[model samples]
Target: MKPFDYLSPGDPAEAVRSVARNPAAVFLGGGTNLVDHLKLGIVAPDLVVHVADLLPATVEDLDGGGLRIGAGVSNSALAADPRVRERFPVLSQALLSGASGQLRNMATTGGNPLQRTRCAYFQDVTTPCNKREPGSGCSALGGWTRHHAILGASEHCVAVHPSDLAVALAALDARVRVLGPDGERTVPFTDLHRLPADTPERDTVLEHGDLVTAIDLPALPPARRSAYRKVRDRASYAFALVSVAAAVEVRGGVITDARVAFGGAAHVPWRARRAERVLRGAPATEESYRAAADAELADARPLEGLDGGNAFKIPLLRRTLAATLRELVGEDAR
Candidate 1:
C-alpha cells in the first residue's frame, strides 16, 4: 500500500478540521473496504483520519420514538439491538445479509453506507474506469458487465452501488446525521447517494470534510410487515445480483402503504416509486403485485449478452419484487 499519514481525532470537530486541513485525507473506520482499495492502488489518499474515537459505539433510543445509532456502531451490534430487530427488521436483515459475521462485527454503520462498489474494473488500476479515474473511460462498459447496473447508468459509467443496508435505509426514509466543517446537518438517506450521470467519480453527496455522526430511523407504524430478500451466486459471503427491501401495509384486503428499494440493479439504491404509486389503494392480489413489479422495471435498460452471460435482470427483478410482496403480505395475515 502507499504511504499515508494517520491521525485519530479526539472528537468529531477535530476530525472534520483535520480532514479539512488535509484535502487528501479519508476517514478510516473498520478499514475493511478502504484499506483494500488502498492496497489495490485504486485510492491513494495521503492521510488516514481515524474516527473510532470521535463517535460512540452503541445506539440509544431518543425520547420521541426515533433511534440514534452512533456512527461507530458495529453491524452486529446494530442488528442485535432488540429495538432495531423488532421495529426495523428490514434494516437488521439487510445488515445481516451483507458480508459475514467477522466482517459484520468489524463494519460500522457509518462506513457501511459509504462502502464502495465491488466492480472488477474499478478495483484494477490496470483497467480504465471512470469511477476510479474520471475521463479515463470505463472498462466495465464493454468488459464483464453482468453484475453492472441496469438503471440510472450513464455512458461514462455503469457500476452498481454495493450496499444492502443503504437500500433498506432508503426504503425506510432514514436520515443521515453528519458533522462537517460548517456544523451538523441531516440528509435523507435517499439523497446520500448519487447517480452516475456525468461524474461517476463522486460516490456520495458528502462534502470534503464531512463525517457521518449518526443515523436516525423514524418509528414505523404497527402491522406493517417488512423484509429484505437478496439473490446472489451463493447463499452467503457473496454480493447480491438482485435484492429488494420492502415494507407493506395491508388493510381490508387492500394495500394501504408500501415502500420499496432495489439493490444490485442500479447505480444507486433505487426507490420503487413507480411500483409504490401503482400499489397504493390497490387490492393486494397476485395480479396487482405483478403489475406493480412490471411498472417498476418498465424503464430498466439491461446490458445484453455481455461476457457470454445474458442479462435477465428485468424479468428477474420483477419476479423478486412480486415474491417479496407476497411473502410480506402472507406473513402479516398470519
Candidate 2:
C-alpha cells in the first residue's frame, strides 16, 4: 500500500475544503470500498479525509410524512428502523438483501450508493478494463459478461452498477444532499449515477471534495405497498443478476400510481419510466404487468462475450419485473 496523509476533519466544510484543494484527496466514509481499492492498487490517493464523524448519523422524520436519513447511518440501522420498514418497505428489503450482517453494520447509507461495479476485469489490475483506465479498452466486451449491462450500454463499457439500495432509492424518488467546494445542493437520486459513455472511468456526477450529507425520502404513500426482489446465483452474499424495486398504488382493481426501477441491468439504477407510464391507470393484472415489462425492455440490447454472453438477463429481467409487479398487487407471482 502507498503511504498517505490522513485527516479526521472536525467539520464537513473543513473536510470539503481540504479535499477540494487537492484533487488527489478523497473523502473516506466507512472505508469499505475505498479501502479495498487502496489495497488493490485501483486507487492510490495522497490524502484520506475521514468524514464519518462530521456527517449526521440519525434518522429523522420530516414534517410532510417523509424521512431525512443521515448519510452516516449504517445499513443495518436503516433497514431495522421501524419507520423505514412501515413507510418504505422496499428500501428496507433492498438494504437487507445486500451484503451480509457484518458488512451492513459497517456500511453507511451515504457510501452504499457510491459503490463501484464488481466486474472481475475492472478489479483485476492485470486486465484491460475501460472503467479502470478509460482508454485502455474494455475486457468485459469479449470476456466473462454474465453480470454486465443489457440496457444503456455503449462501446466504451458494459459494466452494471452494483447497488441494491440505489435501485430502491430510484424507485422512491429519493434525493441526495451533498456538500462540496461550491457549497450545498440537492440532487435527484436517479441522477446521482451516470451511465458509462465515453468516460467509463467516471461512475457518478459527484466531483472532487463532494460529500454526501444525507438522503431525503419524499412523502410517497404508494411506497408503503412497495417491495424489493433480487434473483442471484446464490441466496446470500451474491450480487443480483436481476433485481426489481417496485411501488404500486391500486384502487378498485386499477393501478393509480406506480414506480419501478431495475438493478444489474444498466450502468445506473435504471428507472423504468416507460413501465411506470404503462402502469398508471392500468388494470392490476398479469397482462398489464407483462405489458409494462415489455415496454421498458423493448430497446434492450444484450451483449455477447466469452461466457456465452448475458442474453439470458433480458428475459430474466422481464420475468423478474413482471413477477414483482404481480406480487405487489397481491397476485400469485409464480
Candidate 3:
C-alpha cells in the first residue's frame, strides 16, 4: 500500500470537513474494501480519515417502530441482533450470506453498501476500465461477460454492484442517513447507488466527504415473511450470480403487499417495482409469482455471448424470484 497521511477525527463533522477539503482524501470505516483497493493500486488516496470511532456503533429503535442502524455497527452484530432477526430477517440473512465470519466481523453496515463492483477488470489497474478510470473504456463489455450487468448498463460500463445487504435494504425501503459538507440529510437507500450512465466513474450519488452515518429501516410488517436467496458459483466467499430479496404479505390467500430487489443484475440494487406491483392484490400462488417475475424481467437486456454469456441469469433470476415468493407464502418452492 502507498504511504498516506492518516487522521482519526474527534467528531463526525470534523471528519466530513477533513475529507471535503481534500479531493483525494477518503473516509475509512472498517477498511475491508478500501484496504483491498489500496493494495491493488485501484485507489491512491492522499489521506485516510478514520471515522469508525466517531460514528455510532449501536443499533437503536426509532420513534416509528423502525430501526436506526449505526454506521459503525459491524455486519455480524447487525445480523445477530434479536430485533433485526425477528423483524427484518431478510437483512440479517443477506448479511450472513456475504463474505465470511471474519470479514463480517470487520465489515461495517455503512461500508457494506459503499463497496464497489468485484469486476476483475476494475480491480486490475492494468486493464482499461471505465469505472476504475473513466474514459479508459470498459474491458468487461465483450470479455468474461458472464458476471456483467444485464440491466441499467450503458455501453461504457456493464459491471454490477456487489452488495447483498444493499439489495435487502432496497427491498425493505430503507433510508440512508449521511453527514456531508452540506450538513446532514437522509436519502432513500434505492437512490444511494447510481446506474452506470455516461459517468460510470461515479458509483453513487453521494458527494465528497459524504459519510454514511446510519441506515434507517422503516417498520415493515410484511418483512416478517421476507427472505434472501443468493445463487453463487460456490457455497462461501463468492459473489452472487443472481440474488433475490423479497417480502410478501398474504391475507385471506391474497397478496396484500410486496417488495422485491435483485442483486448481480444491474449497476445498483434493482428494486423490482413492476414485480411488486404485479404481486400486490394478486393471489399468493406460484403462477402469480412467475407473472411478477416476468413483469420485472421484461426490461432485462442480456449481453451477447462472449464466453458462455449471462443469458442464463435472466431465467435464473425469474425462477429465483418465484421460488423466493413461494417460500414466503409457505409453499413448496421445489
Candidate 4:
C-alpha cells in the first residue's frame, strides 16, 4: 500500500474542510471497501479523512414520520432496530442478506452507498476497465459476462450495482443528505447513482468534497407492505444474481399503488417504473403479475452466450415478484 497522511476529524464541518483542502483525499468510515482497493493498488490517495466520529452512531426517528439514519451507523445495528424491523422490513432484510455478520458489523451506512462495483475486470489491475481507468477500454464487454448487467448497460461498461439495501431504498423513495463545501443538500436516493454512459468512471452525483451525512427514509402508509428478495448462485455469502424490492397496496381486489426496484440487473438500483405503471389499477392476479413483469423486461438486453442459463432470469424474476405481492396482500389482511 502507498504511504498517505491521515486526519481524524471531530465533526462534519472539520471533515468537509479537510477533504476540501486536499482534492485527492477520501473519507474513511469502516474501511471495508476502500481498504481493499488500496491494497490492490486501484486507488492511491494522498490523504485519508476519517469521518467515523463525525456523525451519530445510531438510527433516529425524525420529527415527521420519517427516519434519520446517521452515516456512522453500523449495518448490524440498523438491521436489528425494532423500528426498522416493524416499519421498513425491506431495508432490514436487504442489509441482513448482504455480506457476513462480521463484515456487516464493520460496514457503515455512509460507506455502503459509496461502495464500488465487484466487476472482475475492475478488480484485476492487468485487465482493461473503463471504470477503474477511463478510456482504457472494458474487458467484460466481449469477455465473460455471466454476472454482468442486462438492463441499463452501455458499450463502455456492463457492470451491475452490488447493493441490495440500495434497491430497497430506491423503492422506498429515500433521500440522502450530504454536507459539502457549499453546505448541506438533499439528493433523492435514485438520483444519487448515475448510469454508465460515456463516462463510466463517475459512480455517483456527489461532488468531490461532499460527505454523506444521513439517509432519510420517508414514511409509507400503514396499509402498504414491503419486502426484499435476493437470488444468488449460493444460499449465502454470494452477491445477488437478481434481487427485487417491492411494496404494494391492494384494495377492492385491485392494486392501488406499487413500487418496485431491481438489483443485480443494471448499473444502479433500477426502479421498475414500467412494472409499477402496469400494476396500478390492475387486478391482483397471476396474469396481471406476469404482464407487469413482462413489461419491465421488455427493453432488457441480455448478455450474449449462455442462452438457456440467461433465459431463466425472466421467469425467476416474475415468480419472485408474484410471491412478494402475495405476501404483501396476505400480511395486510392480518
> How far is 201's C-alpha from truth in model 3 (Å)?
0.6
- Clash count, candidate 1: 0
TM-score of model 2 vs. true structure: 0.98
Q: Which residue runs of candidate 3 sit more than 4 Å off their true CA positions? A: 331-334
Q: Which pairs, if any, clash in model 2?
A: none
Q: Could you estimate the TM-score for every candidate?
A: 0.97, 0.98, 0.98, 0.95
Worst 10 residues of 2 by lDDT: 325-334
Question: For candidate 2, lDDT tens digit of each residue in 197-291?
Answer: 89988899999889999999999999999999999999999999999999999887899999999999999999999999999989898888889
* Model 1, span 1-334: residue lDDT tens: 7898989878789989999888789999988899899889988899899997678787888765678899899999998998888888898999999999999998999999899999999888998999988999988866787898888899998889898999999898889999999999999999999999999999899989999989988876631378999989899999989999999888878888999999998889999999999989888888888899888888788775468532677778888898988988884443
Q: How do all the candidates rank in terms of lDDT, highest first?
A: 2, 3, 1, 4
Candidate 1, residue 55: the lDDT equals: 83
Tens digits of per-residue lDDT, candidate 4, 145-182, equal 87788888899998989987889889988999999998
TM-score, structure 4 vs. true: 0.95
Instruction: Report the Cα lDDT for candidate 2.
Output: 0.93
**What are the per-residue Cα lDDT tens digits for candidate 3 across 1-334?**
8899999988999999999999999999999999999999999999999998888899999876799999999999999999999999999999999999999999999999999999999999999999988899998877889998988899999999999999999999999999989889999998999998899899999999899999999989888889999999999999999999998888878999999999999999999999999989998888998899899889899997568789999999989998888788884222
Q: Report lDDT (CA) for all predictions.
A: 0.88, 0.93, 0.93, 0.87
Alpha-carbon error at 277 in model 2, in Å?
Answer: 0.7
- The better-scoring model by lDDT among 1 and 2 is 2
Candidate 1 residue spans exceeding 4 A from truth:
222-224, 331-334
